[model samples]
Target: MRTFVAGQEAVDETEFVELALGIDVDLFRGPLEKETAEERRARRDVAREVLRELRESAEAGDEVAGWDALYADALMRTVPFVRAARGQRAGTGVAA
Candidate 1:
């Protein structure tokens, strides 16, 4: 049996597997195609850990003069995404 995947773009692992495995396309679905609930949870957990460290470092006050602002901005951006991830399954866009 012959299989064809059409595109001028570079084929990634997912497309390669699809062609090789006889097109069980779902064999490779992750942060690229769809973000699963487990993936979301893991991402959120890592964010939480990073935030914790950021808070600690900010309290320490030994970094540059603008790191606090960056941390705050990251927190603000992360909040909404984390909240969205908390909702139903993420069959959505690239991010949350």
Candidate 2:
């Protein structure tokens, strides 16, 4: 697989090279950075608000119209995670 370094220009996936003999490579994906306390609180707040909305919608028999809102809420919860994973995958590099 191709190698990368943080802050470098992006490269096409087809251009990745297989590792050579004796090379050391580490692969990491997902959230590589830690969230600050304030960010953590914000995420929790969003989650709680979404769950509350979902419960209210369920109680109101509004399931049909609730999915879109729930999906949007889910996206709000995960977009940062997806972005972080992409950044980590693109930024991590071989040390060999």
Candidate 3:
């Protein structure tokens, strides 16, 4: 949860570059890139709708469902695209 700014003793060039570019170097451990302005607005709208549904479900005493598995599956389906994007971004000669 802690971030090191440029020029910090513990920070290195790769970390600085990642910070500047808004990309994560440690893909397995770092946070995803922040959403764009349009994405933020769209997500806010979706969140409002989800919240309304949750409130309605709560009032009806219905169980609130978690979409963890669905989201995991969706992510799994997008793995190839993600890998391609990462490879393109990194300029690595790997084919996806």
Candidate 4:
């Protein structure tokens, strides 16, 4: 894909954000493309871990600047897509 900026052509980078949000990874498969129990469990695990770490850091009075710095560093090395192994039945279509 391509985009124009100031009348100059540029590579379109919109997909990167979707990858960061894991939208580019297909977590569901099989003939029906339905999410399975294992996928739901793994998502729950990740959510719990993230929440636990955030709560712990907040309770410890960690400085937001410090956390932001670390997060930024991690983002710098972020992969386009990080997904579970293939052939694993996963994904829960849950919403916030």
Q: Please name the candidate that would achieve the greatest lDDT relative to the true structure.
A: 1
**Model 2 regions lying over 4 Å from their true place:** 1-35, 76-82, 85-96
Give the deviation of candidate 1 from the true structure as CA RMSD.
Answer: 14.0
The TM-scores of all predictions, comma-separated, are: 0.37, 0.34, 0.33, 0.32
* Ten contiguous residues with the weakest lDDT in model 2: 21-30
Selected candidate, larger TM-score, 1 vs 2? 1
Candidate 2 lDDT at 18 equals 14
When summed lDDT is taken over every stretch of 10 residues in candidate 4, the lowest stretch is 23-32
| Candidate 3 worst ten-residue window by lDDT | 22-31
lDDT of 3 by residue, 3-91 (tens): 56664432667777555543333332222454444774565455445545655655676543233223322333342445455653322
Q: How accurate locally, in lDDT, is each candidate?
A: 0.46, 0.44, 0.44, 0.42
Residue-level lDDT of model 2, residues 1-96, one tens digit each, is: 546544333364322321221111111111335654476567556656655766587678877436535554454444355556555333255622
lDDT (C-alpha) at residue 42 in model 4:
72
Give the Å error, residue 60, model 2: 1.6
**Is candidate 2 or 3 superior in TM-score?**
2
**Tens-digit lDDT string for candidate 1 (1-96):** 334555423257656654443322222122334455687577556655555665576677846313643544444343244435655334454565
TM-score of decoy 2? 0.34
lDDT of 4 by residue, 17-42 (tens): 33343322222111224345686567
Select the stronger candidate by TM-score from 1 and 4.
1
